[model samples]
Target: MAQPTLGIMTLYLSEHSGVEERSYFRKVIAQAEKLGLRAVVFTPVDVDAKNKRIHAYVYDTETGRWSRSWTPFPHLIYDRCRYQDSERFRKFRRFRATYTRLVYLNRPISNKWGMHQFLATSARIRPHLPHTRVYSEHADLTAFMRGRRLVYLKPINGTGGRGILRIERQSGGHYLVQGRDRNRRIVAPKLVSAKQLPLQLAAWNVKDRYLIQQGIPSKLPDGRVHDFRLLIQKNGSGEWEVTGCAGRVGPKMSITSNLHGGGQAVPMTELLRRRFASEEKIEEIRKAVYSLGYAVATEVEGRFGRLCELGIDIAIDPDGHPWLLELNPKPAREVFARIGEKETYEKAISRPLEYALWLYKQHYGTSSSRRRSGAGKSAASSTR
Candidate 1:
């Protein structure tokens, strides 16, 4: 029998190309090989919708290169595309509409403003969410920043901590604007009023398409602010689980604890232990971290249907309260590799493949047992 085909979909940047090479693809191929599945790579543009065929791309491990081949439409699609308002995404959506029964592993959530509005409906999630308002007229900023010690001006569509400004209301009745440069260096400037906000945001190349969020103090005693990147993914049985977590501590004066800004990734337990003297306090933090991570994933999945994974960023205030910063649909797992968490790092790579397979079986009534499944047990089976 032909193996079940699972396709990984990414947006193509080139018209002439159907496949792009990535280090993670190699890992996916290896994992799929053991699970009796053929892993195919493709872009939406590469699909011959009229013919119901795809110019599928596959990797040659022996030759260390990618080769294009023709294949039938995949049994299932794992959507990892970074969606945009462009025609490409729109066309893909139209093409996807033809397959009414095709299983989409996870629907993409790309709009920051939309996601915030949906998650806000959950009372459990609301406490952790920072007070946020859309940036529009000068009065919006003026009203939101009033009586706040610090506020963050973030791009509504920003990711990886890009295009963010930490505005502090100074005691002298002036505004302190601080942001990060492309080089990860701090770009601190002083602004006199809301009118100057545009001058500070001129570099961002945006106009009022931003959010003003209350800033929680996340710095520790050593003057370093840290963020916990908690990764959540679905297992073979189709359940949300917290795979692993690590603390990303930013440079001494950096606005965000983003790894893109040369931040250090440390084990979460180690950082919490050293920061908290009381074992009870540390245990409380541990519980809070896991609970919040699960809550965010489940809450979002309920509000926004069919999410296979989530990257939840939790920041701890000085008093030990965990604040949910933001949730990412596509999260980078390389930080675990840098931290030497081998088990967690390996599971991060394999869970998506396992979940993809499980989704096929669930909808198609295809049975795959552990004994017949050579893919072995999932990473979720291991203790973190």
Candidate 2:
């Protein structure tokens, strides 16, 4: 008999000290298995990228556990490894090296050291992004602040609205700036003059990378700032598709509408139509948003290989034009739950595994049929 078509899918789960991000990972694996693809989580035994050392973790269903295996290289590997400590970072780098040998689904987008790489490359993505620049030196920021009344400084590798500050020009040559608290609350508003900018910069001098952006001035009809979270996923056919839409409104004083900053999300179709639309233009606006999303995704997909999906954060100005805030290759699953009506997480989340399986089949061929025939017999049992 010919070999089975199905190949093993492996995920490298980074240990989270106290946080739990395993539920979604497990859910995706289960779905992949249900779709008749072999899937499991894995960790490398010895990871050296420049010098390739191959060590793989394989799953055993009989023992209901994962065990390390050296041979029979996996067909696909997803790097969901995170680093929260010095030791973890060391392992994370090693694990990353191992996956680089195989196709990587999504590599780290950016962090402090290299965030400007993405911003600098933003020229090619100009049509899809907001006006942004690296805020590494005081001179760069001072020049940009000239004649501009509204500005924002955000961490280059920031997630969940952390370390975001909004600055606005005020009377008497002073500026009103709003910053988030330890818990991401916008409780303290600082008033500083233009001359105090240097001091302000010194005070908030982040050793890591940061960006000073031109604020997008996004606001609802009632003057509340809000944004949209567009979920894009690749289907089994390996095409990018919008899975769901949701609106996230910033807290009363917050600049970013991230959940960590007390932002709340509502259904896109319901909120957009009910609050700011006429029957004739509802579909037009929806299509516009979707079109913009696809445009942005297509642009980034060119640079990032085999991109399975993206969580695009967008902001709509008063005139109703969507601006791409960010495109996340590895999107958090929690945001989809906010849509309230339709949960599209499975569709988006499952694409990575689907892509992996397809790629494995193309690269290494299949052993599914052989494994299945031997499942109940002695030959397969012995191989196992």
Candidate 3:
């Protein structure tokens, strides 16, 4: 007799041997195994030096134990891999072989034309977005800059406050443009406008793709520009739900409120009460966030249907209107740690685990099959 099988995919695991990082993956893997399922982590590259295996260890939640096992090919995947390194990409293709179902949540979607196409046609989404334009030529960017008082130049595929620029009109023909360089350095904001932009762009630019977005007049409460991060997850019932929501306050005038950009995280309920006096205004924001999440989940699942989770970055204007900043298919859990709250941080990890479990059940079928057949557990479970 054979036990039921489960396949698990993890986008990242620690390369180092420290307890800090290793403990996190261990906990997630163990929880899956405890819930009567096999768990394996798929990595872009093998972390251990002794063997070239992509899957590492299986954690026993009941016993609170971990040991080397034959890597269980995952039934479902949890994508946490931020970016692909050379070594990781080589391993990614190999890992794709074993699993058919993936809770991709965020598979790397880098194609600009495809993204633009998806967003443009998504009737549920188009209205919530700010005016956006993609351009490879300098002429288009210059023209757009001249027309709009404020614009943001963003690398179409970039993430984590990387390679993003905010341009603001300054005195006379001068403009203040702040953006990140290729190496993730903050090049001091340059004073340039349409007149100086061409020369400066030609000299300093490294990205092959860029988008000039009309800057939404983001509201500042207590002198910090703020945005909302809604964490949407799929439950066992197979419906999308808002697991958590937080407000990010950019460290005064920083174009991006990304946690990496010296921003502070506040509870969304706190911001709504403190910043807006009207209940109607707050309700509108709540409605927009909820609507946007559903639309994005639907649209994203339509395009990258395998993905199961999303970290949606949404912004609000002075009038309390909502706009889409970007949808993170591969949003990290580390941001919640910045909030310095234990309960919020725990939900960040646990919600994803719940989604992982939901995906597992969908792919591998019911656990009772294992018990009814008198099978101890699948060899695949031990392998994980």
TM-score list, all predictions: 0.87, 0.76, 0.79
In model 1, what lDDT does residue 262 have? Answer: 77
Q: Candidate 2: minimum summed lDDT over ten consecutive residues — where? A: 1-10
lDDT of 1 by residue, 1-384 (tens): 446898887766555544344677777777788887788788778788778888877877667788889888898887766545567777668766766566777765646777778878888878888889888755777788778888888878747777788888876567788787645577766665655765666655545788888999877778777889999999886789888998898887778888878789998888887578888997898789899889888777765567778888888876788988888887878779878999999999889878877766655553464344432355333111
Compared with the true structure, all predictions reach lDDT values of: 0.77, 0.62, 0.64
Global CA lDDT computed for model 1? 0.77
Shift in Å, residue 179, candidate 3: 2.2
Point out the worst 10-residue segment of candidate 3 by lDDT. 375-384
The C-alpha stretches of model 3 lying farther than 4 A from their native spots are 1-27, 30-38, 47-69, 85-87, 90-113, 182-184, 219-223, 334-344, 366-384
Q: Is candidate 1 or candidate 2 better by TM-score?
A: 1
| Between candidates 1 and 3, the lDDT winner | 1
Cα error, candidate 1, residue 275 (Å): 3.0
